[model samples]
Target: MPVIVAASALLFSSASLAHQLKSSVTTVLFNKRTHNIELMHRFYLHDTEHAIEHIVGKQADMLNSKSDQLQFADYVAQHVAIKTPESESIKLKNVGFEVDGKFFWVYQEAPMPAEPLSGLQMSHGALQELWPTQVNMVNIEGQGKVRTVYFDQQNQWHTVTF
Candidate 1:
């Protein structure tokens, strides 16, 4: 009877390790100014919806099952709009996901639209979107200086200046 109990303990331990090996990490970023919520789904090659379900509960299966061709960017944009925020416009900048050190969706926020034509004509000739097309050009809160290394399309990890 003791032998049988020991074997069961071993089996359970191995199963727990196996479960841990198949899980992934997801990072979500929410910007209050732009009212944007970005999600990054990171998974290993052998990992599946079942594994994701085990890690993040039952709701994981529904999200992990989404096809690669699905428009995640548009979906995120729409999802942000539906959730709504106190701010008028919040930009989703630098949405990225990493799987085994591989990065995906290195998107940067687009420039803000110009003011009305009448306003533009009255003021100094300055384009509303004059700042850089990249993310976090201004160093506010000191977080912008600490650059995050992300893998480019060429599979090379580059330190991008924000």
Candidate 2:
């Protein structure tokens, strides 16, 4: 009985260690003054490190290596998109990326459309391929209110209105 109990405890402990929270949050702000849509994505530092290593097929030093961070940022940029209701792409330019404490952030921005927009479609799949349980949430702030959209392994595109 003791042996069985010990084995069960070990199993549970191993499972707990293997499970990590796979999630990311992005804030999209429409700066009317600048006429730009700014995006800031926040992710777990540990997860980003592992993902960078897996994506580059080598050990990635995300904390100390700027190249690794840039590579990961590029990967993130390729997996994210913001489009208009008419399917016109909103060209998002990579602003930069940085690590702050236990989190890593990727920044992007695009010029706002000259015409008024009713809604925007967004897609985020940065780490979903590697970890199917990964969930990405985007909060868009504009016009004195905030709209939210979520993405996961199953659902890719979500539309939000300003």
Tell me each candidate's TM-score.
Answer: 0.24, 0.87
What are the per-residue Cα lDDT tens digits for candidate 2 across 9-93? 9999987765577999999998888899999999988999999989989998889999999998999999999999889999999
- Candidate 2: deviation at residue 91, Å? 0.5
Q: What's the lDDT for candidate 2?
A: 0.91
Clashes per candidate, residues 3 or more apart or on different chains:
5, 0
Runs in model 1 lying further than 4 Å from the true structure: 1-27, 33-35, 48-96, 101-162
Task: Report residue 58 deviation for candidate 2 (angstroms).
Answer: 0.8
- Which runs in model 2 stand beyond 4 Å of their true positions? 1-19
lDDT of 1 by residue, 79-101 (tens): 22111222234344444422233
Query: What's the C-alpha lDDT at position 93 in model 1?
Result: 49
Find the candidate with the highest TM-score and give its number: 2
lDDT of each: 0.32, 0.91
